[model samples]
Target: MPTQAHINMPAEPVRQTGMLRPALTVFVGLSIVTGLLYPGVVTGIARTLFPHQAAGSLIVQNGRTIGSELIGQPFSDPKYFWGRLSATAPMPYYGAASVGSNLGPANPALTDAAKARIDALRAADPDNQAPVPVDLVTASGSGLDPQISPAAARYQAARVARVRGLPVERVESLIAANTEAPALGVLGEPGVNVLKLNLALDAAK
Candidate 1:
């Protein structure tokens, strides 16, 4: 015969079964809403609202992908206009490793790198004595800026014109044409898309 208290008391009082089902249900619901539904809706909205940007702002020419407008490229040829300096390790303009030199203005390493860039530019075009643009000698904050300041583009115009055997006026006109105005007329400074301009240069007859 069992005791009166044991007979009256509930079985498995210490087991956590009470919370197990509710917790599982809540977990499944939250996972569905957050992990699946939320991302799906956001992606759909982005694809619908901004297809170009949603597609990575890719620059396609002749059914081939040249690059993305969102990333910088290394252009060392004197015939092409170089964009801002990239401090990415292992390679210049390495997409996966976008990073600035993290050096202050007075840092000796920074100064040496800037001097090297200046020397390279001078060596490429010995006769051009114009002061180089600051953007050309310095890397942008992200080290992945696809566009260069308008002044930077203009600074390199003569060198590109001379090497390409194109008229300087023509090159300047190209620069003017490629110069992108500030977004919404106020969001950012005017910049020239270096890759597009170089592509145009190649396409010209």
Candidate 2:
């Protein structure tokens, strides 16, 4: 028999080429749906439905912007109700650097920082005999958290009232007015947003 010519089967088509087509189609479709359409629709709905919140919950005073009800600011004066300690880097209450102290329970640095805050709070309101609330001494996970525990608010009542020259009962009433009940009456704690209380306090002046 004559020798048969050696034949090589054509190389199998590249498997990657087959994968590329389906992958590219899926990627393009998903990008448009999720990255563009979904976000756009949600943002539009929020702006139309919750205009104040969608606009950063900004608090305006006398045609000037003061702060947002969603973020806290540092106030060291006895006349002003203090917010939570900010762990924001480079400076306290720097909204752009919202972050926590990231210190574990046993961290000495955290212990010292917290102790300092406790001492200051005690010093500021010497007559206040109630135990310091943890929220008053520790920085929140998000340094921008605007609200404080109702206990913390009450703790500062006497000092702010005295400095502002308002009656303690009046300041307490303002704090009550600024208090927001738990979401659905159970999801979160009853708290007072510092920005809102401060704005109302200013209006009271």
lDDT of 1 by residue, 66-128 (tens): 998889899998989988889997888888888988999889998998899999999998987
Q: How high is each candidate's TM-score?
A: 0.87, 0.89
Candidate closest to the true structure, highest lDDT = 1
Every model's Cα RMSD, please?
Answer: 2.8, 2.1
lDDT of 1: 0.90
What C-alpha lDDT do the candidate models reach, one value each? 0.90, 0.89
| TM-score of model 1 vs. true structure | 0.87
Error of 1 at 88 (Å): 1.5
Instruction: Name every residue pair that clashes in candidate 2.
Output: none
Pairs of residues clashing in candidate 1? none
User: 20-96, model 2: which lDDT tens digit per residue?
Assistant: 89999999999999999999999999999999999999988789998988888888877788889999988888989
Which stretches of model 1 miss by more than 4 angstroms? 1-23
